[model samples]
Every structure is written in C-alpha cells, then in structure tokens.
Target: MNSKKRAWFVLGITIIINILCQEYFFTEQFINFNPGRHNILYSAPYFVIGGLLYLYRKEIHNWMNIIGGWMLLFCLVLNIGYFLLPISDLLGHSLFPLLIVFTAYHMYALGSDKKWLHNKIIDFLSGISMEIYLCHMVMFRVVERLHLENYISDSNLNYVVTSVLTICLAICFAYCVQRGLDKLLLKKIA
Candidate 1:
C-alpha cells in the first residue's frame, strides 16, 4: 500500500479501538474493577500516539520541535482555561490527550536542553513500559477483589493507594521480566 493509504489505515484502526474501549468501559466487569479500567485508560494515550507517531514519523520528526514548541504554549493556554473554568468538561478532558501528544512529540524530537528525558531511569521505564501496562491490570484487579476500597472508607484515599500500589507492583513485575530476558540473552551468548 502507498504510504498515505497505509497511514490512514493505521489511524482508522486506532479510532475503532478507541470506540470499542469506550463501550467496554460501560460493562459491569470494568465498572466493578475501576482500577483495571483506569490502568487501560492511562495506557491508551501512549498507544494512540505511538501508532500515529509511526505513521507520521518522518513528517513529525522533521517539524516536531516547532509543532511541539507551539503545543507547549498551547498547553499552557488550555491548562489555564481548564483551571479557571473548571465547570467546562470540554477543555479539561481535551487537555490530557493534547498534553500527551505534545509530550510524545517533544520527547521524540529531543532538544539539547532535554537531556534529562533521555536518561537511564526513563529509558529503563520506557523499555519495560509495555510489561508494566499488562501487569498493572492484573495487580489492580487483585486489589479490587480484596475489598481495599471498603476497608479504606475514603474514596480518594483508596484511589491514591490503589494507583500507587498497582504502579509499584507493575514496576516490580517489569523489572523481573527485564532480568529474566537479560539472563536468557547472557546464556545464549555463552
């Protein structure tokens, strides 16, 4: 397929996945385990921009600095609007995805000043991010199953604890996966 048509097809697939996700969020399974759904929702933007980035890599990288630079300013505007006018859902919800894409762009087309983003810690996390993504759902489901929410009594506190615990557990799982792969590769080298 032509590059133009290929990119369009990828984008079409992404949109369809997003629509299905919206429907799945309504199901009882997801409703009962909100953290499971929350982890998936948090993972969505990364995958979305990844597909889009793959399709638009050449063009995006070429002008990403400029585009992302403008987006950084636009982000400030949207954030301020959302902050002052918390009554509006449109900009508030919209800002999250916009910021995601903007950050993705800037990270890809890293400037000399953005050396921190290219560090080992972020690299380690990014390398195992997909593993973390998969592990978090299972961890969250277990948390929910344990009635952590009921014992906690406070909704906000439960949310924070659940999210933090799931994230930490996911990181541990990812680290194990990384170590396993490293061992396998070393054995193969020997």
Candidate 2:
C-alpha cells in the first residue's frame, strides 16, 4: 500500500468523524465523541499538514522555495514571525495545533539552515516529546492531588518551585520510560 495515499485516507476518515461528531451523529449516552480525549478527530487536520510536508520532504526549499530569491528578507521575517507569534499564550494556547504545524516546518528549516540551532538536548527532547507530554500531565495531577500548590503561602516562589519540580521530574520519568520501551521493543527484537 502507498503510505502517502494511506495518510490521505486516514485524514479523510478523521475529518469525516469530526464532522459527524460536531453534527451530533448519535446521542451522548449512546456514543459521543465530542470534547473528549477519544475525539482526536479534529487533530486530523494537523496530521494532514504534516503528511503533505512528509510527501514533499525532498522538495522543501527556503522562502526561495516559495517567494523565490532576492526577496529573502521578506520571507525570513514572515517565517520567523509566524513561529514566534505562537509563543504568546493568548495565540499559542488558542492556535496551538496550527502553530504546531508551523513549528514542525520551522524546526526543519532552522535545523537545516543553522548549525548551533539543533542541539543534542533538542534532539533528545524531540525524540521523547510524546512521552514527556504524557508523563508531565500525570505528574501535574499528582501535585494537584497532594495540595502542593496550596502548601506555600508565598505565591510566586511556590508556583515557580512547583513548576520547576514538575518539569524536571517529568523529563526524568519520560526519559526512563522511553529507554525502557526502546530496550523492550528494539533491543530484544534485535
């Protein structure tokens, strides 16, 4: 099977599912895929963008690729601004997935263009980003349950400490889990 075509088919299915869910295809008690983790249908659009980029991976060029040469400055500003604007929580949190789509391409562009831009830490983090995301949520939940947030009367420092601890522990846990999975699935098979 053509994987590219398969990607398109999956995108189509997700889009259809999202539309159906939005339109209330079924009763809530019977089968509701709205506003739930199970409803990953909306994320399909992001996947589609990535899939298209993957298929056209070889053809990716700089803004020279899009706007052509000589107007490089204009393209550079546009590209950088496109990614940087998403850093603000107002836009970032709201347009996160779309920003994520832009981010994927931005990373590719930056990594290819600059040497210092792509570091080992970034590589490692990107490799286990999904694990970090999954593990971090659990850690945050634990902190919330233990009333860690309410413990300290000092607002700023307490919040900072909790955030720092959460992130550090999350990275450690995610790394361990990734290593374990790697050994179990890869090393054993090999």
* Top-TM-score structure, candidate number: 1
lDDT of 1 by residue, 7-116 (tens): 55755565455546655664576675533235445455555555556666666556655565665565566556545654446544433555454555444544322567
Which stretches of model 2 miss by more than 4 angstroms? 25-38, 61-111, 133-170, 180-190
* Worst window of 10 by summed lDDT in candidate 2: 63-72
Best by lDDT: 1
The lDDT values for all models are: 0.64, 0.63
Candidate RMSDs in order: 5.1, 7.4
Per-model TM against the reference: 0.62, 0.48
Model 1 residue-pair collision total: 0
lDDT of 2 by residue, 3-104 (tens): 777777876676566556555554476664445333445555565656556565655545324543334444456567766765565553433445354645
On a 0 to 100 scale, what is the lDDT of residue 115 in model 2? 41
